[model samples]
Target: MCPRCRGEALLWARVPYGWTNREGGRVEGRSGVVLCPACDARAPGAAALITWFHVHGRADDEDEEFVRLLVRWATGVSVPPLDEHAPEAENERWQRGDL
Candidate 1:
């Protein structure tokens, strides 16, 4: 799940097909689903899709940030707050390994 959009439900099943980098490099990686959040409030089809960018045997943190920013820009809504209503965060008696 994207750290920015913590509250939104992520669709982590959309595989990334391709990606381009800031240095004009194109790369491919293992096919896997993307983690994304839907912005139904602003638009019906607004979504932030997280994709992996493998460049020169390394993944850039900037690229990941860019994807996150892109999603917010496209959706026009701030990423939902994470764990705002989670029961675990609010529970004081729950132990880490209680489950």
Candidate 2:
């Protein structure tokens, strides 16, 4: 089970390093050491970038975007963490204006 989220066993998921959100704005993906969904309680960096950049190892020539992300993450740089919780989505909150 995940130690961070503490739910299902951390599945091998494919998360992007960075991408353009629905609004066409660029989103930055951190390559720094991230908290493991599990095992961190037992040890830090346990996940060892289990699933951050390039899932299958390295990026291919055809997928130029992957190559870029791979290099960006491989630089061995760690950025400060954002501990704040994400704000609720506008639609998720029902407002009186909706009537």
In terms of TM-score, the best-performing candidate is 1
In model 2, the worst 10-residue window by lDDT is: 41-50
Clashing pairs in 1: 14-34
Query: All candidates: CA RMSD in angstroms?
Result: 15.4, 13.4
Q: Judged by lDDT against the true structure, how good is candidate 1? A: 0.41
lDDT of each: 0.41, 0.44
Across 3-68, the per-residue lDDT of candidate 1 in tens digits comes to 445654444333334455668787553343323433332332333222222222233446766556
Model 2: clashing residue pairs?
none
lDDT of 2: 0.44
Q: Candidate 2 regions off by >4 Å?
A: 1-16, 31-85, 89-99
